[model samples]
Target chain A: MLNLRPCTLTWLVLVSLTLMALAIGQAGLAGWGILALLLVSTFVKTWLVAEYFMGLRRVALRWRLIMAAYLVLVLSGIALAWWLAARAAA
Target chain B: MIWIFIYAELLVFGILFLAYAFARSRNVVLFNASQLELNRTAGAVNTLVLITSSYFVVRAVAAIRADRAEACARWLLAAVGLGGVFVVVKLSEFAAKSAAGIGLSTNTFYMFYWSMTFFHFMHVLLGMVILLAVWWKARQGAYSASEHTGVETGASYWHMVDLVWIILFPLVYVMR
Candidate 1:
């Protein structure tokens, strides 16, 4: 029953994702493609934390959307910044 | 009140993150090189530690909801124990950097690195305090299944601390 809990499941996924991100970092991969993948992974991890660990899933829709917007806006800003840097280097 | 604080905290961190991204963009080469000097393993381990502590908090909440005061206190204690691990690991990491002669003024990357992470470190300390207070109350059997707002509030705050690190780890240590 402990293993079947939602929080337990969420923790497992979060750990696996953290390891995946660590591996990506250690791989020394570069370029926009790797960055995009990392950002996507980040988005997923943050969303999981918000939805499950934070218990936003049981809250009002507006609250969940607010969290979503925060993630999107910040990640988009990062992606855009990196994209501009890449373009400038090119 | 906790929700408002969470929103305000998130806003502050978001600005710092965006500022970091902007600064990194301006000097991508230097940022990338400086990032390579950071101990990614430490950052990753801290991530796991925080996440696990968060899980412990979730269990604490569950225990309280089930009217298990002793179990709730035990879980919160476990969470705080992990928080101690984070502080020790982070301090060692900082000490190692200091030993290598790194300071806030070392470079743009180090500046952001020191400022942002130290800021997050303070929050972790505060979150641990909040958890301890809630834990104390739980130990006294002050929170019941019908009235456990304190536990929930503290859990929320702890989760926010973890949430910030989820972004910070990737942005600072990994996403070079």
Candidate 2:
């Protein structure tokens, strides 16, 4: 991450998670939990990779703002999904 | 050029991850079972291989910039060598799993085990291609300190591969 293109790595991780979810979704709740955990893992990985690989810290203010906004959208979506699921279960 | 492209690549992967998450939420047991299909020892070795390759690429770029073509080539070869080990181990693992009746159709877990790994294996192949291209470029004096952007970019991407493997080793094989 301290080196170059982290987004590339993030993409790889994301693909891995996606495949895992697709392949394992037929299993049950444990599968769901694992998938959720894997997504969260990918989210963190993507952030770190973007920051370190893309040098977002060193980039211009506008680009940084864009990146930050994108991340917020991601986290918010995740929160919303979990919240909705909980509410439904309740 | 490389940076922006890499970023776009991440976006593609990011969407895929989101899709996977949504799918998993609909079913959890299969995912856990699939995770078990992963071999711990192989994952560890692959992680080590990626880390070693990343180090070699870093050193290779540095050496090339210093006009030490032989050293640069040597490091590049080392990286390629380790990457080769990774591929071989991965394929053999596939064979072992199949012999164990753990084929892709065995369960949800096996499907993921194969899909994710095969996808990753393709990337490793791409990385090796990049290394080969760089090797030729270096031999022809195409990269010096100021003109080694290709090598630098490739190395950076290579390290990201290592990082992914590090996270994956723990997440898929260990955490369960």
DockQ of each: 0.84, 0.09
Q: Against the true structure, whose TM-score is highest? A: 1
What's the C-alpha lDDT at position B23 in model 1? 89
Which residue pairs of candidate 1 clash? none
lDDT of 1 by residue, B128-157 (tens): 999999999999989999999999999999
What is candidate 1's lDDT per residue for A7-62, written digit by digit as tens? Answer: 88889989998998899888877777888888998899889988888899988898
TM-score of 2: 0.67
- Counting clashing residue pairs in each candidate, in order, gives 0, 15
RMSD of 1: 1.3
| Native-referenced DockQ of model 2 | 0.09
Interface RMSD of each: 0.8, 8.8
iRMS for model 1?
0.8
